[model samples]
Target: MSQVQTSRFNHKKYQSFQQSMPALKMENRQWPSNSITQAPQWCAVDLRDGNQALIEPMSVAQKQKMWNLMVKMGFKHIEVGFPSASQPDFDFVRWLIEENQIPEDVTIQVLTQARDELIERTYQSLAGAERAIVHVYNSTSPVQREKVFGLDKQGIIDIAVRGAKKVQDEAKKYPMTTWTFEYSPESFSSTETDFAIEVCNAVINVWQPSADNKTIINLPATVECAGPNVFADQVETFCKGVNQRENIIISIHTHNDRGCAVAAAEMAILAGADRIEGTLMGNGERTGNMDLITMAMNLYSQGIDPEIDLSIADEVVATVEECTQIKTHPRHPWFGELVYTAFSGSHQDAIKKCLSVQRDDQQWDVAYLPIDPRDLGRDYQSVIRVNSQSGKGGVAYIMETGFGINLPRWMQIELSRAVQEYSVRHSCEVDNETIYKIFQQQFVQANQNFEQQYQVLGYEVHKQGEQESIQASICDGSVHGETQTIHGQGKGVISALSDGLHKTLGIDFQVQHFDQIALSKGTNSQAMAFVQIKINNRKYMGVSEHQDIMTATINSVLAAINAYIDAVQ
Candidate 1:
């Protein structure tokens, strides 16, 4: 036969499908009473649906890596791949059986169309696994029947019955591998509710699923309709109408075409779904599948153990994005960059005060943040940053984290104005480091009074032979314009400078530990140093930055003494 003739025959075969039968409509399309408090067991379809949608599908090695990560994340049942589709998929399934060390408790699932050859191949793929499930599905909606496939209602039913028999017969060969029969009334959301139940009941009978060999009726809101509650009502009605509730596990697969997939799945569980099939971050064909991570995390936040490990969710999202070439939006819930970050002034201030009061992050409300970023292996450095939107709280956070300089209430307000002005002018968000630099340039350096209180003109260090000592010459900027060039010797350059200041200005203070950190990337990155000084049991802080550590050290020490004097009087 010609290729055109072959294409025509295939088209006719699909078009022969019939319309779904309608049943008595309920008085009110409402969800079941029990749906208020329930969460379903999750089965991630990333390796199958997600991989199929990727521009460049993952290699076998990459697929193995993803599977291992998913298993680590406590996924007991993972739809690994569609085995009968291609050579690589077949090889990947065989690889899991031959080489991969799948856990004794975990079950690997494979998908295939409702055909005998594919069903046999699917069974071949499950060689030595302790637990394996065969997912058999065929389109049953009227649109699919009339437009896509020319099948009458009975034609679709015959296809389903034959498919279920083939799957059951093939699965019988593997008596050792516990078999699970799952059927999806493909496009169930759009099909007549009564017809969907009828088809599902037929499969349940053909499979002869006992309570032990439980069959799964995966009722997907394949194309989401109306609100989530409406879909919930449909699931509730269908579950109530199905013949064998004890012998079947009601599973939900919702697509996010209407952005209600997650809500629908949650409602479905309430309406009586025991299992869930979705993709991570909702990656799939159309608008994408429901996001399992979001739903699972939602349950976690509500104090319900969804029985999934989300500790590696950050890594999972990153790996999937690389393979799929789709970036997770920065505003995406739970994992977004700004999800835990707060740019608003009020939120920043509250978080700063909370951090000050309780060193433990768990105790803080962390307004606008649901969970601690550290819990997800993310840093809290970006939580509070500066912009026109920032406030005194943001400035204080910068002082505390970037420079060890703790500003008083009055000082914080004074600096917030300058930082906010700069942020607005630049039209950009600022980091703690930027706020620290601004604070230094204005409060520490711009004021001549502060500079005059104590200023070091120049200093040189010379090591003496007898002892490891250093000598430095320094000048002071006092009100009397007093420039006293004094020479002092001490163990270190900072010590020598402190000694020179004490002698010249009649000021005495003990130099505490000094710290320096690189401010940027490059060979010539500036080293920012903070000097802690204590005089008469009162602590003082000073910060400075320079290309040379020695220069920064000298400036930092003097700044500390100046701050102490200003604080005291």
Candidate 2:
């Protein structure tokens, strides 16, 4: 009673598990040597699996919206729903058939269990469908067979064969419509490859498919129980053993329980799968299905057309979010809000250099970015965000892209330090507007605190022969804040202004760098001037914006003078 020691803490209480799923026992497996050259026929299961997994299934209107979006994305085969399992699903299928919302080129696929009654009801829901696929499934894994259905190997085979027969019989009744049959030995990932081939072959024999009406043998990694390589082996084994290879479409439906659905789908394709069934953004049960968006973009990044139009990825994300009520994770591949953004200093610097170069072709060669964001309807402004970790290149990118101000190399370093200080003080990301404001406060408005000093009230410049004369009026606060007018002659307005300031207030500086550009376009467009001046071996920068170029230049020089005075004082 004082101290109880229990044997439950011993590791021997748990049984040892298999290190890996059994590898297919063939030395001549071709899948490992093959590469995916073309895209497989795509089938989106969002309406069925994706919808059923939702906490609140999509209403009829929402289903219609999703259906329209899929059609627009050019899906030839779409699994509308498991009509026999849900009333709304049945009604949605009937509505599509009756209202003729189903396009002639598109074929609607509906799912059903192995039971005869559910197969009959599934066909009823698709009675008037012009072209449809009847997908029937029965679990075949040893655990599902014994624990879920309490059936042996022969018993499971009977269920698949009977379901295939019933679907073929019902499809024959509709003489005017084109019908395709798909059979899934569900949970094929955990099933013995030999037994899975037997059940699928039995279903194919009952369906009696020809090349014109090929049967789809969908092998679902329904629970994703193994690594991608093991799943690929399972597919290779089934493809090798299945009879009538040309008359069957070997399809793969993968889940993401182990976060390997995309990898599994790609491996299955390499293993000779002819079709892929998945949903957008991987929305489904458990960890969700393989993300068709990721898979398609992966193909695109490799110079292969995924055969789906993803130019409007933002719209696709918006529609899916609205229908599913699930916000896309910010780090989701290709489609997330922040996938393309670079917060690291080195990454931003590399990206800035890449974007600055002009390419002769449409090749995307940017660093740290797999695809051009512009290709996906996103602009380059949001690619680099400023934080405490930001560097000169990232800050310069923001200024050039966001505010149209191309800061010089030296100014970039200067502004980056200010921005980093601001970010550290606030402990958050600095927005574009805040960055612009900081720039203005540092350069353009540097003289606000020294307003009582010498201020340029007005300035006029005139050129004569090779000489330019500038007459400037200033309020000199150092001289009891009195107003004084001074004149000087030089080669340009900037030169003349420097001479005038030196004569009026004994302030002398040499112009190091001067640049100007129109801030915008139009008759009323303003001009921006950037001036760097060296006073007593110390450098200072100033910026000014005004309607007149001469006035902006003068203001910039005066602001630089005040900044230099403030520093020395």
Candidate 3:
């Protein structure tokens, strides 16, 4: 039987349905030439759009917690909810007003559709808000008009104009409360540029805003269907064509269907947008809104204060994760747990060197790190991690940062090889504790085979004339288990001890290197000694820690001798 053949995917089948968004025809576009030098007005829509998209919408208590967090984070404008859509939303709005949870400086905004009953219900919910923005929107895109609303261009304009007029009239019933009107051509990105301008101007005329009373003209990329540049062009065209530009504040609300919400928002600001509406970490409908945290940090990285206090970023992420039941991705910019950690050998080495230099000028100049982690309350200890890919520099960094053990330059490479071998055998990351244990077992502690081979019983040193004399007691590990005493003279105690060992035990080994450092800064602090020696053409390293400097040096030399003996036997 002949085998069935499979052909390549049929690309022609999808061609008939493909469509391309036309670029806006505009000359002398200024947005391309403009740079974002200052931060735009920020409005958090977390409690409204973000809450609604949750698998289980936030309860009143959860909503209150989120609201309090946002207030503490320095947000002056927060869209609390779409009061006219659901009972919980309406109840939360009413609770804020009744319980006096809203701060006086904060302006709460609520969303509604372009209908009389919804607008009236929305205004009723905002009965006693100190200052509120009554946001009204209608579907104005060509596809939305033809497919969703089944309305013509004039019919769509009537919805926006009628809603603006209703919002203006309903706001009068509560004369004590101040109201600002906001209108959106809901799918402005997909709408015809001229028609969007026409509808927005009609609403602007109906509201008749002035310098004292500003109207917000929000253009939402309800569904991102084009590249970010095209969205910027649409924004620029509306800014140029809209009427009463002086009294109008252009606001942008972009979704992340194409993963370009943040880019679009930034470009919109370049295109003369005055306000940005988004949720924390980009939580919203479908692909979610632009992440306010990411965008704000982007601005902060460029030396601009984003006007929001993100120093408590970890707390913010924790609260959002607990409330939303969604774990933040480990690679989330500026806030993720692993974002500040370095595992690559070259990266860890560079970071280790960069942190060692003391600079009087406080500038974030570290390589592979855009912003200092300390700015977000993270310490430098966790910045470098040791794994199979780590190098000697990283191992040294862990030792110094974690345990205050500054290994010598040659010792670093030696210890790094041992650590890399262990990491490869286990195929996992080595923690600081594990690395410390390895250091102890390899240098400070005697190997199991040579545990009772030789022990430093006691030692005493005295200066005689121009040289030092040492008398030492030692134990020999043999079938007889004999103890011996010997005396020798040399330049120093360590040298005298070496000479004593050769004279008494008949074991000769030359000390190659010797170094010592205080383990801490205090009069009674302990000291650690490192010793390297060559015995029978084989080199070995050892370390010892004790309160007395002389004792630590003797113990280190004995440990190195035992290590070499264990290797040979």
Candidate 4:
């Protein structure tokens, strides 16, 4: 018996998110009425935000590979690095500019803290770019303001004001390059809604952004502390209170600390945010950023063009794994290798039926799959993988699709049980080839699966009117038992074979079922036969494939007789 153990830590020490974060002051929120109909302005932050979260950060080569991959995926704005903090980041930025690597259309962004020298260093890194966004941020949550910075509300606002002025002064030095300024009230979700608006407005006043020359006001859920609805309320309240709402691009940067980063980002978008900042595969600090891959796929599933190419999703995920030195979980959403694969019996059965009626000209309406996996370069062959948990429909689908052998209902039931036993015995999923092999060895009696007590050698059938006669040669298990022929007469070849088996073996069993199908569609097509017998009210089944229908029928009955004999012994 297991003992009841109490938890060691005290749960009373924790506070609810509402108690910790400041309340919103909106009289009537309008975000609930909104819905996401289109993709937002996307900014890839794999290098800046994602890199900082890595325990062993990407090497220069890895960073370059990741950068090139991001460009190819159609990201208009990519936060390349935190040039002000890391020397490697500074050098990489310089390399992009010096080597003419920045594309004419793409805008590379860099991040920095709201400090004097770091802000200046950030500008230095983007020296010769045609256009760039200099992102600056400072923590503004209640805990961060009081405990970390030991600053009052006004003092925190002053820090942001000074940073904004310095950023404006530095941008004047480079008149040739187009500049877009971005400021973040980091930890915005847990900060007072009115206070966050005030800081953003203060920064906007210094920059004086206009409709023609826009700037970004990023609000980061640096540590997600509430539900998506609460975050949406905070965003809506900020959008209403902030200055120059038209000029300021309300961007959301979310962390998955509470696993609601994407949910919050989606809600914030409905709350009037215009941009999203995230990393590929959601690789960032803690639980990582909202997975851009999942978000993009979500949009794609909804018939919205994500503006990013995911056709080579399998290849892209492999590259991300290689560069990050992290293996994607097989069950990870969308991009995982096995997310499109089904192992459960019900899931596989539904997927098979849906796929059979699916057409390229029509909308995707598969039962288990939301989107056609072929859209992402995945073949349908991997859709329904068979395992111990799989059922007849899955086995039948695999048999027909993989080997072109259509299994009848009764045969599918028997084959599925054989597959389950084999899978359990091997302690793994039974692959397509293995499923076929199992059928051949266990049912067809072709692979010497076990010491068969009755092995069919050959058979000849004679038909007159509706009556039939069969003479089958089989090796009955005994000391020096030679191949012997047994003769029986019945209404057809199948009944004659059953009659011969029961008379020879002295086991009275009724022929419960019989079936057959062509292995191919030509004159040289092989015949596959199946048989089911009931002895002592217990059913046994068998199968065989051969060029001659008579031979296949004979072997199939003999296989069933062998199964019954083995079970009785």
Candidate 5:
């Protein structure tokens, strides 16, 4: 081992892995030309790998909960636990078998070391299993062999061969159950490529696999030491050198020591790896294992079927957090709370523009959004949040989607300024309900400080053919809403009300922009009226909601008039 000195850092710990490990000699790598066009055979190692890495391991009940969720998520191959290592793990395996909770299509897997007692106990735990995999491993890397075990190459080979034989012998006793054997040269990526092939080949020779009974040769980057490209090279070389290609399923389990676990896994798939072993959200030792959620969703984003049920992303994150007791980072890829949200001014503007023209039948092409949030049971309400960094488009989007008030461009610009000022003053992001209150205070009821206001008491409209007449009682902004009767005639009820207001208020203004829509879906009874008027060439708007559309229209006219009155006085 070598150490170096640097002024900024202790460059000491570091020399590239090339110094310690033999460099892979594959000039003609084939993985670079390949792309991940299909999903691989996925096996979830949550129960074993994910559980062991947790600070506090999951209870039996928690383990069962996770197991059922995995089954629900369409995981056909699940590594249940290391049955021989713990009594609870052994009991859980027995519970699955005795209670018949294992689905026929799903094959539960258990792990063991090369020792005979654990190997036999692993088999005993799978006594009545319909189909199960017995995964056995031994460390084959140079460091593990020389420093940890103080063994030569032949010693590692003998351990793997003996473990394979013991596993085969145990399977013969449980003839009623179907068994699949798996071998991992633990820390396979850190081992010399040729030596790893030798150990796995020795194990394969003992198992004598066939086309019908394929053995899984899982090559894990147990401690990731190289870049994804280098790992791809290793995988390609192993796939080419390994024997019994047709009778072998080349699998990979990668760690995130270098923060490239998912990338390495994808590259390995291109290098002819057929199956993948990982935990949900990449839960494992050290930097954790490859994340199956990210891997599957990556495939989904590329239009490939992931073969897993990932419709409710929240459900997956919640379940994993509960079992692991590890709170997911809010910025975790794909499933985090803020993953799909945007608060940047430019980003929000672009997202709102792209989403406005998006159609469900068309391909997703929204700017700043890789996939539709609705695909994961999330509405667009959270897609654009208004903070100090937000823009008009985001404010308008939140208002329209969250509260059913679609602001026009000018209105969006006006209200967004108010929202920005509020956010800056309070130094916090504004939530939806708070934004609604802001809209109400600023636009709909701008006369909140006015001592005198208009109130619509009651009205009657008599329609004779196309002409109409209205008789109404209204308060003229007096101290106690003193009642006054007014009458007017016009072609419609709206015109009649306007004419009556013109006579009673002693002020005249034409409606500039008026629109109304049902505030809630399914019925038009609950309606909101938007009325805008120009006073002295300046625009003022008012909004009013009521069970009766007629009352809403009358109140909105009064509200706009009152806003104008406040401005003038």
Candidate 6:
């Protein structure tokens, strides 16, 4: 075959071809009233559309992996590939059925132009499949006649009728397997609507659609000529005009040329489309196909079950990127890295307040957010970040959630001032480590030796074989300008500290809970301890830091005692 045979029509001519259509806008698109009526079956063109768009199309193994993922995700109908175009595609379909890899419930579809040799090969590829759909299409637009293929409308119809008869004849050989016939009027969006309906209606009569298993008429707004609503109008008009409604399944295949493929699809469904055909993350030729993941999850957020398992959408996209060498943007809807992240102060403040409210009711009541990120397997940490655009509530929430520190209103205001400045210097994405480090530097400090005031330099305890008491020796700065060692026995470290202080200075405090956490990763990470103590029924909190948890606990107890003494003095 010459290069001209494989070549597509010029882009300029397609744009010029669209000028004959009506000019329309989709400024205020509305959601469908009855979301439940929306069809659940998705005919994923990932292997054909997505694979072809790759810089290097997938190997047979990679295509099989993608096919497996599609079947696993509950797609009964999948367009595997255009088998007539490449030997790998033919081999893949043959291998799938020959190995019994094609699931029983799934019906694999293959694409072919309206040519006898190609149609025969398309049939040859599906010989082993228990169920298959023969998808045949021909270019029906006027531009193909005058500019590209030099074929008139009648000539195109003749080719289509011949293809339809060939498919019908082949179905007789496979008596057990159910044969589905699908026809697409290539470049139908830019084609004359009446002509498209005419050609499709003729194919419908030839294929003989029925009430039980209707022939699917896939009307692709192939290049996305206008806004989504207009496409919806176009689809509604076609469904209304097409003969034998009960005998036809109207499907929509939209490209994202104007970035309205998703919108177009949703609106088309509202206008009565029975099936959706697209690729994951809109990966295909040009701007790619409509993202079924985004579309399904979009309905999911609206409290509608799109009936497709999208929980592994991220994994599928990652595998596609690896296999195809195409990258998914971090800001892509649903699967993007920063889609759930909020750095603006006001946004974070609202999220924090909303979270506090939601905790009480276990329901969402927030501004600018519809569904919880956790519903999509995302965490709450990235929902808010401190930045120049941040508000005071965000800082307070971070302090309260990330660390156990709850600042007073006055302190919160002061901290917000510092946070705003820091946010201006570094972009708004302040990580958890930076916030913890900053809190430590500003309020807590490391000290080598305590200046009297009940210092706990070191401590050791010995329990003699399940005895009721523990003996402890605590080393602290002595009153006589020396390091003094004191011994006491109690139930635990807090009790031991209280007993030793009572023996030395006649001051005592009740021991409370000692809370500790490993502050960082790795074996050398420090332990942070918070000790709560009671003196005359008045509670005081003291925070301590040390590499060893035991030492940190001792320091926390001593710090609490010193705080009590300072309060009294």
lDDT of 6 at 332: 88
lDDT of each: 0.78, 0.88, 0.88, 0.87, 0.89, 0.76
Most TM-score-accurate candidate: 3
lDDT of 2 by residue, 1-569 (tens): 59987766788664421333455677887888999888889999999999999999998888999999999999889999998998999999998988989887889999999898998899889887778999999999888888999999999998888888888888888878888989999999888899999999899889888979899999999998778988898899899899999999999999999999999999999998999999999999999999999999999899898999999889899999999998999999999999999978889889999989948485778998888898899988878988999888888899988888888777788888999999999999988899888998887776555744566688777899989999988776666778889898888888888888789778789999998878778999889888899988999877888898877888788778878877877
**Per-residue lDDT of candidate 1, residues 1-569 (tens digit):** 65653344454443211222333356765455553454577788989988888878888777887888788888888998999887788888888888866888788888899998998888888878888888999999888988988989999999999999999888778888888889999988888878899999888889887877789899977777556766776788898999889888999999998899988998888877789999878888788898988888788666677787777657977876766678998877677667777777898888888777665734535556666677667776878777898789878887767766666565577679989998888898876677877876865564335745565565567777532333444545655546557566677667677776777667899976677667666889777666678899987767676787777777778788778777776
**TM-score rank order:** 3, 2, 4, 5, 1, 6
Q: lDDT by residue for model 6 over 1-569, one digit each (tens)?
A: 65656456666655532467754343433444534454456899998878888888898778878887888788888998889888999898888888998877888989998888898888888885788888999887777766888888888888889988988887787787778999999877777777788889889889888787789899887787688867776777777779898888888899999999998988888877889999877898888899988888888877777787777756777776766777889888887767877766677767777777776446565665677877666677767667677677778778878875655454456567766767678766566667667656543442223355455665667765442232344444435445556666666556666676778667667766566767766888788776667898887656677788877877777777766766676
What TM-score do all the candidates reach, one by one?
A: 0.75, 0.89, 0.91, 0.88, 0.85, 0.75
lDDT string, candidate 5, 17-130, tens digits: 878775788777789998888899999999999999989999998999999899999999999999999888999999999999999899999999999999999988889889
Worst 10 residues of 3 by lDDT: 13-22
Candidate 4 C-alpha RMSD relative to the actual structure: 3.9
RMSD of each: 11.3, 3.3, 3.0, 3.9, 4.7, 9.7
The alpha-carbon deviation from the true structure for residue 261 of candidate 2, after best TM-score superposition, in angstroms, is 0.6
Q: What is the clash count for each candidate, in the order shown?
A: 15, 0, 0, 0, 1, 3
Which runs in model 1 stand beyond 4 Å of their true positions? Answer: 1-39, 355-364, 448-569
Instruction: Give candidate 1's total backbone clashes.
Output: 15
Candidate 2's clash total is 0
Q: Which stretches of candidate 6 lie over 4 Å from their true place?
A: 1-19, 23-40, 359-363, 406-410, 415-428, 446-569
Candidate 5: global Cα-lDDT?
A: 0.89
Q: Write the per-residue lDDT of candidate 3 for residues 165-259, one digit (tens) a residue.
A: 99999999989899999999998998888899999999999999999999999999989888888999999999999999999999999999999
Residue 460, candidate 5: C-alpha displacement in angstroms: 14
Off by more than 4 A, model 3: 1-19, 358-361, 447-449, 457-473, 478-513
Lowest summed-lDDT stretch of 10 residues in model 1? 15-24
Candidate 5 structure, TM-score to reference:
0.85
Highest lDDT: give the candidate number.
5
Candidate 2 wrongly placed segments (more than 4 Å): 1-20, 359-361, 455-477, 480-514, 521-525, 534-539, 547-551
